[model samples]
Target chain A: MILPPPEPQTRRQLLRGAAARTASAALAAAAAPGAGGVAPASAAVAVPAASATIDRLQRLVRVELLLEYCYRQVLSSTILRPDARRAIAPFEGHVEAHVAALEARLAARGATLPPGPASVSQANRFLARRRVGGRLGHLRGDQDALRLLLSMEQVVIGAHFVALLKLSEPALVELSAQIMATGAQHDAVLRLLLPPHKLGSAAPYGLVQGVQ
Target chain B: MVGDGGGASRRALLGAAAVAGLALSGCGATAAPASTRPAPAVAERDLALLLAALELERRTVAAYVAGLPLLPRALRGTVQQFLSEELEHTGELISLVRSVGGRVPARPNSFQLGHPSDAAGVLALVHELESAQIATYLSTIPQLSPGPVRAAVASILTVDAQHVSLIRLQQGQAPVPSAFVTGAE
Candidate 1:
């Protein structure tokens, strides 16, 4: 289940953290776990940097397909209004571009791209776990649809940024940043639509930008 | 959860980002107004990168802000909050550029792919903007040392994904269309 993020940190609480010694200690205390406790950094999915490029690409491809499926399902299903479909249509094209571009890049490296989202069948299984109701979920209304998209945006923003950091190719890193920037633009819109309580009380509630 | 020293701390970026994420859920009744700082001139290289990034962000902020107003009331919050997040990001970029001695341009380039109508127009704009943004970070990420600059870029890169989702969500599109998402540097 998608649990609510930890309680918003108070100004004094955050200041106390700044005085701490290390990233671990700070994150640990911040995420102390119970009522009013923060979820430690260790609890969040660590961006796995141990894998080979090919492996990373494979996993990313899976995520991309999954995201595409979620959007398509939400759009095509009875969830959103008919007028909203017009707005959602371009996203499919965007994904198609991402897929084609990645496939071409992979092909040049002699590594075949995994099948596009269309060819991926288990996408529903992957997304169902993430959907609000934990199934091939349906939005209760426009608000729910918007919220679902916002949640997905957090993940997307994290992915491209992660890709930029993890990828070995300098050029690819640049490309990932470009892809990432677009994601940023989309995210801004999602954020503006949210309510006061939902916006977390942190700098990047979406992803952890590893420090040097 | 940021402290009063939030403005002075490294974690300030982290604090505002939470608001960025929430601007969508109809949450965030009180976004502490960031103390305004005027944009100052930045280094040449830094300026280019910052402007590239800023222009891209401004375009997004404008698109959503402009679009949200056009959306029906039932769907108002989604687009509105999205724009607010962009505004927050715009603040980040503006401050960064100024701190680096760069000047943020007065106006952003277009997000429109020629005309305003048609799906292709929107997709083309998305493709162009996404490509440009990716290029902006790509060109800059390698040059930045393993420090704040790097951290900033990484942070912003992640925010990009949020933008991608809204673009996709609008047309019944997917959040991600491809499988290759990592760079093993």
Candidate 2:
């Protein structure tokens, strides 16, 4: 998280370094018995560490927290009915499971363990008050409450895309890409639920490098 | 060494491990602990902003999962996919917070804002949340760390931008604007 910035160098430097490896890999692939281009022997290329593995894992965890907070806020907003709350049950369960899994990973990395189920509800409250209503491609509909939900989701989907681009860790970019992809689907679903005018609002505003 | 401009925020410390636990599990998708070694010197402001951003995502994931069943089957697939993405983002954030040696929040039973049972309500809430996400990221990018973190914030902002467009189109807002929070930066 606190890596010192590497000295700025030209893209040429990286490309030159990559070129050597790429050639070696190409040779190895060709030499492999029965290896085909379709299979691309040694196809597993080394991506930039920033865009590769570790950072991807890290971003995945951070984005999870963002989503959790968003949902908690929406839940507390009180615009939904009982049935809606019931529908939300699965998400809550999912969040809990996510917390457990993420914690386990941190344990593996020799990192510190964050809070557990003990404080999940507090995250929910954080969501409640944090409203993004007055800002951004603000849309309206017959159902005011529904509009609110859609807007909240829009912001989340966008946040993922941001992580994907900024993280230099290759792993993190991959992870962010995955998350961004899911956000696209969420944007779609939310659109369908919203009123016509609000349906596709996720487009120009919601795309995360088109990771979807 | 860690400087005031580099210390991790409260949420970053608390959130990493928790998010790591959830993200790896996969809500189809989506905190921190202390250690023997010293923590990184992440900017406090960046840490705080990022912490909120991460928390926001957690809530969004939770809402999507809970809301999936409420929608008709057509929307279910989309909802699940989104849930998964949110999970991934959350997972990434957990590592970030811990790396900086900051405290993050744990799971919550109920968020302060109430939830909606109606499809329309859910959509509305989603839109608003996404908007906040976009603006927040934009606002923080400038002040975040000088390198990858700032870039990461911008990347997140891009995602928000895309989200805004999609939501706009989904809402039937023709001509989804080029930007959501233009001046956020």
Candidate 3:
């Protein structure tokens, strides 16, 4: 008999499955007594916590990849002015750096690296989940492009903020915060480059909670 | 016969409990002290870090107020906006500190904000102060327990980083010079 192809799995489904496995392992370890007839706290808490960190890291890597895809598209477009291009070229490099760091983290955790958007449809789906779909096609001019980029940066910042709340490891938390700060910088710079060029518009609020 | 079985099971349970107690004691002796332990619940370290952040914010507020007069007319509005936002940060941090049962330090009567003769000097000072604030938040975020407090500090750090970028732009320098904002100049 011939076998059918495996069904495609969403990122959320993969994460959920991993989390369930981790919890099951933790429970098993907790239920089985050790030589001392007791289960250590680490056995019950550490495994699940580490698994949670990995899950958050994986999610963030996906976010970074989406950003990389968006940045590459904008950089190749003719919508940006020469000056604007000069300023934004560095931002793409920044996204790449973020991806590299996050990828290394996932590798350390022995998790598979997630893929970025390989087509326009995939990119739109990513944006749609964030409630900002079809924005890529709306960049009719430099102003429109800058606005979209600003919104994307805010999304990145918010992603990191949410990840920080869930990450249990100190090093991962620090890394996420560092990356989030850079996203905010990108947002501020894009605001300055936008129309009505005012410094006040760059950082309108003290709290950088992002567009969410 | 039932009485005999019940006694035997009770003895086995007692033996297991004794073994568990010994294991716990051994683990406690090898582990770090309770004072330095990192718990999910709020601890003294969290309170201390919050207070430190609050102090830095208070100083920033004072610096902005004192340096406002030194800034050029064109830059005053932007600096004023930053000052207002900094004040808001101070308020949020104060509330956080209090929520965690920390003693809020009294604001200093005045900060010795260096005398900057021109807009350049004032901008430079503000840039330095903002960078330091970013550094404090970066260092504090990892140390803080995973919760709304850590998230709030990260949010503030991002805004401070943005301030540094804007200040650099006003200083005729490249904005966002680095991929990683590590709080380093």
DockQ versus reference, model 3: 0.57
Indicate the fraction of true inter-chain contacts that candidate 3 also forms. 0.88
Ranking by TM-score: 3, 1, 2
Which one wins on DockQ?
A: 3
TM-score of each: 0.45, 0.39, 0.78
Tens digits of lDDT, candidate 3, A25-114: 656765766735455677667768777877888788888888888888888888799999998899998998898788777665556678
Q: What is the DockQ of each candidate?
A: 0.14, 0.06, 0.57
lDDT of 2 by residue, B1-185 (tens): 11323342334322432443354343311211212223334566667877888878766665555444446566555555555555555655555566677776765543433445455555666677767766565555555564455544454455544554454544666312321234121
Model 2 residue runs over 4 Å out of place are A1-212, B1-41, B179-185
Distance from true location, Cα of A191 in model 1, Å: 5.0
In order, the TM-score of chain B in each prediction is 0.59, 0.69, 0.75
TM-score of chain A of 3: 0.77
- For all candidates in order, the CA lDDT equals 0.49, 0.48, 0.75
lDDT of 3 at B77: 94
Q: How many residue pairs clash in each candidate?
A: 81, 201, 0
